[model samples]
Target chain A: MNARLYSVVFTFVLTTIFVLCLAGINALASGTIEKNEQLEFQRSLVYVFNIAEDIDSISDEKILSLYGNRIEEITGDQTVYVVNKDGSKELAFAVQSPGLWGTITALVAFNEGGTKITGIDFVSHSETPGLGGRIDEVLFKEQFRGERISSDPSARVAVVSGQDTDSKEDARVDAITGATRTSESVQILLNKAINSVLPVVREVVE
Target chain B: MAESKKTVFLANIWKNNPVIVQILGICSALAVTNNLTNTLIMGVGLIFVTAFSSLTISALRRMIPKNVRMMVQVLIIATYVIILDIVLKAYLPSISKALGPYVGLIITNCIIMGRAEAFAQSHGSVLSFLDGVSAGIGYSLVLLAVAFIRELLGFGTVFGVRVMPGGFTPWVIMIMAPSAFFILGAIIWIARTPIVKKK
Candidate 1:
């Protein structure tokens, strides 16, 4: 009985020590980690704006300076980021849709007119790597640039296949060859973002 | 008794590799191996979690009640994995984003649990710590090897730099998960030959 009690006490003490050590390490790294996340968000914002400069080459201070209080968050039924470029407004909003494996969350930036996609960046996703995951790659994302949303309320952005996108003026993106499901999800997400969030922003901006 | 520590360390790397020999952690091995850098970071992260968790569990082995042992073990492992996830998100946001949900999935990795139950439970704290590190290194080495093959063939590159000749056409299939299944199977086959022969 004495031996068993001793064993129990020993285990309790050891587990306590382990937990404390991990807590200490986490505390130490917490500040740097937070700063990195902020910087990354800033970088993503810059990319959506089609800023040609290198994101990392510029310091966080510079990114913050460029941002220059131009960004605002809407507090309402849905959260949206409002960025003013001169008198015109650009609104960045988050959209979530199901991918092949799991949910995908993206930050989509649209011009005030809601006619053009200013920029887009994936905030989070769980798509299959090297296939569905290529949506996060710059080359795939670049296709969305300057895409004009069709004015017809009934018509949505169509992700087409095996066709040359000669008409950049149309808001049609060529879906990735092998990632039909993931590409379809992106189209669905954009449709939701445009229909639901764009109307809200249009009211605020107009 | 002294030699036992040395044997445990060596055994994890070759005779009982967690990925190749035991065939654990195949999911991340397939998912992240498309890029060398992500694969390396994932391996390092796993090593850190496995090593420290082993040390902690081994030290507490005597006191934890047998009835509640698995629960406590999971709790302990989860805490460390969360710490790893937080640190990565804070410091290496890009890599962290690339890694996605796999970092969280480390808690469910069988190797960490296997080590805690099989080795840490029976061993002293110091020996168990070494065993954990050995197991992690063993896992990392095999993953790196698989990553090397996958990245090179899939992208025609190493560590994201283009390496194939100008005229070379990259194999698109190499980038997919099915390719990893084939490559890993080949590796397991080759690795098991000597062991089978010796037996």
Candidate 2:
């Protein structure tokens, strides 16, 4: 066989086989992968709503029950997940802002008055794993917990390099040691969310 | 002249290690060796890709024309890598997310291509599979060693556990790219001393 003809036939046959195999594998695994993704999203919702503690050990069944029992999903211009605690209602809303590498989506929960942040959880981000990615760490997320957002329009929760002294009204949280860019992005996102998303959510609640 | 299966299998781990001696797959050696967990996942993925790709290529060695041998080997390898990626996504989404680009980049890992061309194309299926497995092991060991030091000094932990004492301060350099070069260099120097003395 001529070199050209043999090359064409050989490559054509090999490509067909490999493609068919990949297609089969993708088809078989797509459903399970989608389910896992959905489950992970549910876990994030439960975490942000403070419905469950130690979510890492919580199974899919546990997350579903906790989420279903405590959180109610309201869809509109932005989806809000509501949590009722001690006869008062708290609302969790998703915040989308550009990060160092890609967009970071965090679910931020507010008290019934929308004055204090009850919880924060970064659902998705593309920051560098040990550096900027530490934004997802529990310590970092905990900084925003129980932080009050002042009535001033420009005020929001902030991540500082060192300790924040005004633990009561400062609304400042310590940032990751080596992740300045991600920290700054988070701060900006917090202010943006406080300014814009809060009012819309307030109207929804009222 | 066929070599013994034992020698063929052990060759890649020490005698002619793909990382230390032949130096085939260094790109990933530097990229994913910052953390122990990422290094382990990348190592296992490489081992799986190399072993199966080698086996498939060797089995079809006779039918593959000389003009398109490289093309066939790559196709087989790419198929295996895609399968690994999909499986990781389905079963272990967290690890899959951590690996990110390194998973897709396995298709271009020279170790798989080098083994397929040098050993799998000439040897029988069984021998080729052994060579592939050993090569991956060699690469994995080198990567894990580098990651151990990087993670320990850089993060004061191993696999995210705080192994370092309370007084220890983390080295910022260890977590960055430059640390990989220094660690990889020192590892090669230490690993190659005995290999060179034998000659």
Chain A only: TM-score per candidate:
0.85, 0.92
TM-score of 1: 0.86
lDDT of each: 0.81, 0.88
Off by over 4 Å in 2: A150-155, A162-166, B151-176
Model 1 bad stretches (over 4 Å): A1-34, A55-59, A69-91, A96-103, B2-4
- Tens-digit lDDT track for model 1 on A1-206? 67668557756775687689778988888888878767677667777775537754777777887665656767676777777777788888778878889899888888887889888898778887777888988878888887888765443567879766657687788888788999898888888888877888668655
* Cα-lDDT of candidate 2: 0.88
Listed models, DockQ each: 0.39, 0.73
lDDT minimum window of 10 residues, candidate 2 chain A: A150-159
Q: Per-residue lDDT for B162 in model 2?
A: 93
Per-residue lDDT for B1-22 in model 2, tens only? 5599888878889989999998
Model 1 chain A: worst 10 consecutive residues (lDDT sum)? A150-159
Determine the backbone clash count of candidate 2: 0
lDDT, candidate 2, at A96 = 94
